[model samples]
Target: MKHSICSFVICLLVCTGSLASAQQANPKYDKKLADSLKADAYGMKMYYLVILKTGANTTENKTTTDSLFKGHMQNIGQLAKQGKLVVAGPMKKNDKNYRGIFILNSASMEEAAALLNTDPAIRHKLLDVEIYGWYGSAALPMYLPYHEKVEKNQ
Candidate 1:
């Protein structure tokens, strides 16, 4: 029984030591990391979250629809390039009125409204937008570069 206890203690120590080593600070955890993470600022910043709902005008003209969609994508790219848009994507499920979402970089509702106005989908009345101010991580601006690196397709 004494021999078994000693062996168990030894095994526990070895496992804990390995675990502690694995939890050590990463080598690249430095001032740059803190700055990149915006750790010095407040925990959250104000942004606008726009929920796109299906508009009243849903008449299907394939060519017009395609053109508007292409223009919508172009507008999204442009907004992202200008840093006005943090993230935007469509919802997969169509059961609800909720269509897609846009996370805008502005704290002002008017600014978000102006940005949404530029989207062809919204302009053409293919999609109606509802904007709400959101408080979220200030680290969101840092996600784009990482997204670009990991994305397999365009």
Candidate 2:
């Protein structure tokens, strides 16, 4: 009985040590992947501010304004297809007064600014475009795969 109890304790200690080591070894971001992301960002990242436009004087020219809105969406779709857009949509509820948002990836702010300037929405005065620098972590929330595993186990 004494020997069995000693062996069980030793096994438990070994298992606990191995688990702790494994946990420590796990990292949120992989070094190689992060390096690649940094490289990608060095070339691909450009900051953009999406201006939300609201309908003015809703009482008159509703149809004309609606047609203009459709054209704006088309321009956005074109940009998205060309991989210039990162994120685009309207503002959430309880946010500032803006009809939509767009995140663009370009070589420089000037290039992004130029692109926005050419947009039909801006030309038609349907919306305004604000360009800014985008600076953030390369790793996405979903990139941390270990969190899912930990949650599953729990």
Candidate 1 lDDT by residue in tens digits, 1-154? 9999999999999999999887666556455656654554454678899999988778959999999989999999999998889989999868767789999987489989999999998999988988999888777877887888998988
Candidate 2: tens digits of C-alpha lDDT, residues 1-154: 9999999999999999999886553335466765655435232323465665653434437787777778778877677667566567777655455777777666678878777776656676667655567764444322334444775542
- Find the candidate with the highest TM-score and give its number: 1
In model 2, state the lDDT of residue 40: 51
The 10-residue segment of model 1 with minimum total lDDT is 35-44
Task: Tell me the whole-model lDDT of each prediction, alpha carbons only.
Answer: 0.85, 0.63
Clashes of 2: 0
Model 2 regions more than 4 Å off? 1-46, 55-60, 93-95, 137-154
In lDDT terms, which candidate is top? 1
* Global local distance difference test of model 2: 0.63
